[model samples]
Target: MSRLGVLRAVCVAVGLLPALAHAFLVNQWETIDTSTKRAQAAQDVQPGRAWIEPLTGMDMVWVEGRCFKLGSPPKMEGRDGDEGPVREVCLSGYWLARTEMTQGQWRRVMRNNPSKNRKGDDYPVEQVAWDDVEMYLGRLNSFYTGRVRFRLPTEAEWEFACRNGGQQVRYATGNSAEQGSWFQRNSGGVSQKVATQRANRLGLFDMSGNVWEWTQDAYDSHAYKQIEPQNPLRLGAHPFRVIRGGAFDSKPAALRCSNRGFEHFSLQAANIGLRLAAEVEKPVKPRPINLRDTLL
Candidate 1:
C-alpha cells in the first residue's frame, strides 16, 4: 500500500525475472524427433569415395565393422539398470564425424548458429534438437549432390565408438573423467572448444562430455532386452530419442560409456548437440567368371 513497499515489490520481481526467463527457455523445447527427414542421395554419387563437404571441413572417420559387447557391465559403478542386459551386437563399417558438429559447421550448412556459447567457431554447437538435425542432414545431403549420406549415430554405434570400438574404458578415453572429459567440475559452466582435451583411442575428440550427442535410436526402456546380433533397433517411433556421452553441466558419473539419457524429439537445450554417422557403401566385387578379378 505504501510507496516504499511498492518499490520493494517491483525490485523483487525484477530480480526473479532472469531465472524465470532461463527456466522458460529450458522448458520451451518439448517435441518429438523424426526419422525420415533426409532426402535420398543423388543417384550419381560414387558410393565408396571419401568426400568432404566444402563448407564445414568435417572429416569423416571410418569405424570398421565388428562384433562387440554392448552396454555396461552389471557390476560397474554408476551403471543404470536400463543399460543392461549387456548384450553382444555386430555392426558394419561406417563413418562418423570425428568431433561433435561445430558451430561453424552448423552455420555453414544451416545459415544460423543456435549455440549458447558463441565463444568460437570450434565450440561444439548446442541448442539443437533431433528434428533440427534432420533438417540439417537433409540440407547437408543436398549440399554434396547426395554423394554423402549423413545421419545421427545409432545408440549402439555411439557407445561402441566411445568404448573405442569395444575396448571398454570407463569414459571414452580413460578411467579418469577429469583427464579426458569436460563436465561440471572442469568445464567452467560452458562448452569449450573441441579437441582441446585428450582424444579417445579411436582418435575421436569430446566423446565423453562437452555436450550430449544425439543418436538415431528412439528411446525405449525395454528395447535392449530384445537385442539382435547386428545393428539392433535403430529405426523406430517413440516420444523421445536417445542422447549419450554427457554435457558440460553433467557430473562425471553421467559421462561413462554406458550411461544413457533421453530427450523429447524436439527439445533443444543449450547442452544438447550431435555427431554424424554415415551409411557405408559395400565394396563392389567382380563376378567369379571374370578372369581378371580372380587373378587380383
Candidate 2:
C-alpha cells in the first residue's frame, strides 16, 4: 500500500478519525452553537458580575462607579502638556468589555474585518475609523432594541476604568511599565492576541499597552479646564477624537494611564482599535428570608 493509504488505515485502526472530526466540528461556530457549551457561554449579563454578552459573546465586567481625579497630577513622572490641571470625576457603574474588541467579534457584527494585521480572529481589529465604529455600535445596539446600549467609552470613562475604577493607578495594568502588556520594548513591531498578558487589578487586559483605543470624546487640549465632575464627555469642537492606551510602538511615557492622544476622526491606522462599554442599571439587592415573618 502507498504511504498515505497506510497512514489512513493506521489512523482508522487506531480510532483517531472520530476524535479529529469532533474537534473540527466544534471549532465551527454554527455547528457547536447549538451545543450546551456554547449556550452557557451566551448567557445574559448579570449586573455586578462578569458574563458573556449573548449577541457577541463578549466577556463584560462590572465597574462600580466612583468619584476620582481625572488627570495626571502636576508632579507625576511622564506628565504631558495636556494631562494636567487635574479635575475631579464622578461616574456611574457600567459594563466594559474585558479586552479590546477582537477581529472575530468585529466580523461577526459587521460581516467584514478591516484589520491590517489579519493575524487571527482573537487579535484586536484595527484600521477602522471612528465613524466606522459608530456604525458598528449602531448595529450592535439594534440587537437589544433599547434594552442596553453599547458604544465606545468616553475619554473620562476610559480613564476611569484604566485607573482601576478610579483608584489612582499610573498605568492601565496598575503599574508603571510593560509588566502586563505588549509594547515597543517587547511587541516585535506587531499586534498580539488579546488577553495574552496578565489582567490588571480590575481584571482588564492591555490597559497599559496594546493598540491605541478609540474613545467617544472629541479632542480638546483644554478640555480639562472645563471638566465636569460626573460622566464628562467632550464633543463637537474639533475633527480629532480622543484615543487612549498606547499602541505597540508607543513608549512607556505614552502608556501612562493619564497620557492622552487623539487623531482625526476619519483617521484609521493599524495601531488603532477599540473596546466597548454599556451603561447598566444597578443590580437590585435581594431581601433576606426571615422565618419570623410567618409568625407575624
Which prediction has the highest TM-score against the true structure? 2
lDDT for 218 (candidate 1): 87
The TM-scores of all predictions, comma-separated, are: 0.77, 0.79
Where model 2 places Cα greater than 4 Å from the true spot, the runs are 1-43, 281-296
Give the lDDT of residue 75 in candidate 1: 93
Q: Which stretches of candidate 1 lie over 4 Å from their true place?
A: 1-52, 281-296
Worst ten in a row by lDDT for model 1 = 32-41
Candidate 1 lDDT over 1-296, as tens digits, reads 89746765776778965665566566665432222222223342233344443446776777887888888778999888889888899987777788899999998777678999999899999999899999998877654433356788889999988999987789998898987899999899999899898989877899999999999888887768886888876567787999999999999999998889999999989999999988743456865697788789
TM-score of 1: 0.77
| Clash pairs for candidate 1 | 31-266, 32-265, 33-265, 42-146
Predicted model with the maximum lDDT: 2
lDDT of 2 by residue, 89-169 (tens): 898888889999999999877767889999899999999999999999887765653345688898888898888888788
lDDT for every model?
Answer: 0.82, 0.83
